[model samples]
Target chain A: MSDSDSPSAITWCAIIAATCLLLFLFQQILWLVVPFLLALALYYLLAPLNKKLVLSGLSPDFSAALLSGAFLLLSGAALLFIYPIAIAHASEWQIALLRYLEGGTRAIEGMIAMMQDKFVFLRDSDISNDARQNLMNFAEQFSDKHLGKVILTIAAWLPSILLAPIITYFLLKDGAQLRRFIGCTVPNAFFEKTLYLIYALDRTARLYFLGLIKVAAIDAAFLTIGLWLLGVPSALILGIISALLGWIPYIGPLMGLTLSIMVTATDFPGDMVLLYWVMGLFGVLRILDDFVFLPYIVGKSMHLHPLLTLLMFFVGEAIAGVAGLMLVIPILAMVMVLGETLEIILLDTRLRARHTYARNLHKRAVTRDLNIS
Target chain B: MLLNLTGKFQAFKGTETPQLTTMRGITLFSQVATNELRAIKGLLHRRTYIKDEIIFDEGEKGQAIYFIIDGKVLICKQGRPQDGAIAELGAGQCFGEMALIDNSPRMAQVRAAEDCTLDVLFREDFLGLIETHSRIASKLSLELARMMGERLRQTINSYVL
Candidate 1:
């Protein structure tokens, strides 16, 4: 965003191309990428605390170790406390979940019936019957066909998730050393600009992730308050789950709404009014998120045009499916930072000339002593 | 083996690299204590330049102040051949100090008179110190202000005469 190095049209194209390529590559090694991304977000979340410790006279190594240790202990303690409660309610949750699924199926059937009543064409056609049959089949086969697959996927992800803390620890500790290593590779003429580029890239990523966390927190609070007011049971948990699910852009909000509808239907059975209210609440939240929360928070941090953002989501989905949809914006933000800085460095005639001059000077200096000998 | 390793560790800990020694001698860092200097050292980057290599050009955006560790450098103006070199600076001296305060374009070009080593402190790192290590930053800032004031006085004197 620096005026001195405004990105050119070619640079913009390159950034988009690189982002798509990286997204495709990321999908190929998604297990590693997912954990690495989680670690990056965790690192940014814990960085300010680690920085405070360092400023208080603790060595970076010591601060990183201390922070990581405390995080592990806290996680372990929370797990220990929650595991027993979860185990006790396991059967209850399973039955509730099954009931909710059935409720969701029924809600869909009701909506179709209502539509058919409103439109004689729908009632006459096979669309309503076909949809009803599909819903019934899905509900019946969900536990038998898909539950094991879901469980297996989670089990596979466990070890990769465990890598997050280790990656975060190193990032906290040796971040400066890594930066210095990168700096060492550049020639003297480009060193300062390269250093600034590194700083800009780091700032962009941190701002984006922090903005996302802020948006998520705001969404959760509003949802929790709304659900509580509506007399929904376990409103806090449901709100939190819905807000987390809302991270996946277009598909995520829809999924969250479906979840809320399922819970609302099951909790207040035969109450079409509650279902309608829940749908209305989600519709309002979606409006607020799109127009208010997203524009001011995540959108501001990225500095990307709304049209480009929408296009990228589709391009990302086409290229790498869901992973691309989730990763595109962050990837584009990073690529923009890199592309802009690189364009400045490459396009500057003086800087490139200075580098060439420095090389020539070095060559002369070496030969000056050699010729005398 | 433990005793020998401990002895080696003590030896290593007691020694200061030449760059750090040179940094201590510079007027900008003169008020900084050894411990504070060590803290600031983490923010410094050292690079070597061959003789006659242009360090930075006139009118270029400045981002860092460089302290000379070895050899000398010439500060000159571009397209002012008659004026010749304005100043030749040697070891323990620093140039581009004004960059630490603002990102204004450089007023003069600087080139190495001889092969040299320098430790660079970037403006962002110095600003970071202002937030986290105020005392050290204030001391360095005071020294910088005093140096700039002296330079301003000389320029005034030259004009008055």
Candidate 2:
């Protein structure tokens, strides 16, 4: 009469079905959900600092307040000192980019002609011409159709972005109490497992976010140094963009390389020598990043298989575009942890016994009600 | 038919409620400061079980240590549930303390011999306290070690005699 024997396959199927339904509902409300999720990420990033301050003899409230104040001051400093410089650079970059695009088209045409001349096979082939035309069309379409819409969408999301800090502040201040309230709702047999799952998720998210920041900083430094040594214009800005893009995993590094190559192609124009050198530098740095820095600094925290990660990336992109691509890995990792933990608890004899007991009691009440009616 | 079997078992939820003061009497937490105990108390899960209810089964993974706040609990070896009652614990005594040190399957089953109230300290919460309050962690670990030593001495003495 073991409890584990009583819960049939139907129960497990029901649980999975319910989870999928809930996820579908969540996707429908993603606009509201995204801000809270961002706040939760911010809370995980900052909570440890608050805990350290408290451990050093400060009250939790005071620590949270101090950290929040410092964060606001830092944001203010960036706005005052960095925004003006960035805007000025953006205007220059816009003019430079337009000039580069015009020059780039001529460069591509010349390269195609040279390739066809050098390879007699290509001279007779129409494929080279078709490929060149496709590339030009893609660039033209992206610049004309997509870029403005992307900027407008970002402007639209500005109000929701403001809610993140306020949500994060309350989370940091009352995180434990909120956790306790959630914990209390769990049945006695599952209480410990729930606590363990929460702790594991928190640790995993904290390590992942911290590891990402470290990886980005290292990438930015390496790119900046490499570009500066190569005498590329606006090395700092390009390096920063590359580092930010690096967060997107496999596709991101390729995009960064392409951007660097375009800038190199523009600056050096017909200098294949300098373009090859820049490509070589980016290739070497990418190898170092993937093989050495990412493995050591990130340290397999997500434990996701590379193939599965790629699949998730594609699926996320299809579902919610770029934001989904960025968020899917962490969310999937968390869900995996939660599912495994819940499965263990659900299969536990004690929990099953409790459930069986409750179900029997419910049956008795239902039968009694039917008898009375 | 499962319902019939469960219906035959008498059920009375234990009335005892665990308080911070009760933690002072439990040997594992005795040396912890009052303020620290209050914090620890918040982490404990208080639960009441009916008589004949299975608290936990043998061979199941343990995640928490339980202190008996009221009534009695019977600990039995696997495969001899009816004949073997290895130990019976009452109020102030704790069982499953080894779970706090490491995650392992329970060596024995624990069932409520009578309606019982228990205060459970989960391993993760205990580790969390150890991170935040090492002093309290050290005190509890020392007490746990002392208790193990006493149990070992008693077992050896019984064998020698």
Candidate 3:
């Protein structure tokens, strides 16, 4: 039997169904959804600073406006500075990408040769030469077919992504008013409970997102320092990208490992020793993340089982692809909270009876002065 | 006729509703200025209860204090009959103030003795006030402490006599 506090199977199904539906809808409007999600993250990140400002006697509206304006100015200046430099070096960067791809292909060939040498049956079969040819072809095809599309997609995202700060400013300034509006709309019989639910949902999202930022910061620091010490080129950029990718759970860390391996192989083609060290570094990072950082930082915020998390990852990917992967956990966590709260409210016979009584009371009062007789 | 219409128009435009007027006389808000009271009004929620309706059950976790704006309410111990109500409170009086300090199970149940309207101030909003408007919060806190002390003295006197 399920614990009393735990949601029933029907509630769980509803939660999952709601999550999938929302994910599908989000995938359709990904441009808007992406910026909105970013704004939510920014809101949580800056909320503490806003709270401090409020405590220091600034009105929420003034504090939010100040923070949003400062963020816009800082980001705009950085973009202006970087835009010219990025354009000037665009062709050089493309060539550098191809070189890295070629280096990665060679590293694979080297591994194949070493494996074939160790296994006499493989050496006799000409597997190394065949694999080398296949790797070279695949690398060339990827650069030719996918590179331009990737750049175009990023360009398209830039304008919509700028909406994040504006949305965050509104959220900070009017969040309480929005909450008050919602409370006012609910029937008085359910007012307090509804307010408590809103408070709980806000707290859950805030803690989980803030915890994620802390975990990412820790991962980036560890990887950057490790890669720099090991002489990996562009170590800081690689570390940050990998740390971000790590947000997607099992698949994310694996993708990060693949990226680091490719970069290390490209930068130091002949060094199997360094390649092994890079692999070992990621392996340790994976272990530490699974055991230490996640549990300590994120803790019970998700309150989801590991098996359920893994299953949802596949379901999310199947429904919305990469966007699904990114959106699923947060959506699921929120739906879970909603479903559980609704279940408790629906099952509370006393509360339901009280609501009915109040409704009838209101009806009688309204009719008392009528002249139906 | 022209003057009466203008007076009615002014009443509609004014900030002081009947409930706000009742709130102004509440002992807990005695020292608060009109501007500060308006700010506090934003943090209060209005609820109405029918006669004999249970507002809250004893042992339920308390999250807010309720001040009657009209009509009356009965404060009673759970498992006691209607005739055994411990206190009958009228307009301008408040109950559940202890919840502002802690989230303890309510010490007693409350029911409407007649059709009533109340303004509720939640603990979360109160704490937020403490953060942003400490001066107003301090005055309210002092009144709350004084009220509690007065009640304690009355209880001790009853026992001693």
How close is each model in CA RMSD to the real structure? 4.1, 10.3, 6.5
Runs in model 3 lying further than 4 Å from the true structure: A1-3, A120-131, B1-53, B67-72, B78-81, B88-94, B97-104, B113-150
* TM-score (chain B only), all candidates: 0.85, 0.84, 0.86
Q: Per-residue alpha-carbon lDDT of model 1 for A85-121, expressed as tens digits?
A: 9779867976777788988888877777888899888
List the pairs of residues colliding in candidate 2.
none
- Model 3 chain A weakest 10-residue run by lDDT: A51-60
lDDT by residue for model 3 (A167-263), tens: 9999888876787788788775567766766666776787788888888999999999999999998899989999999887668888887777788
Score each candidate by Cα lDDT.
0.82, 0.73, 0.82
**Global CA lDDT of candidate 2, please?**
0.73
> Which candidate achieves the best TM-score against the true structure?
1
- Cα distance off (Å), candidate 2, residue A101: 4.4
Residue A356 in candidate 1, Cα distance off native in Å: 1.3
Candidate 1 lDDT at A48 equals 71
In model 2, which runs have C-alpha deviations exceeding 4 angstroms? Answer: A1-30, A80-90, A99-118, A124-148, A193-200, A233-236, A285-305, A341-350, A357-373, B1-52, B67-74, B78-83, B86-93, B112-119, B125-136
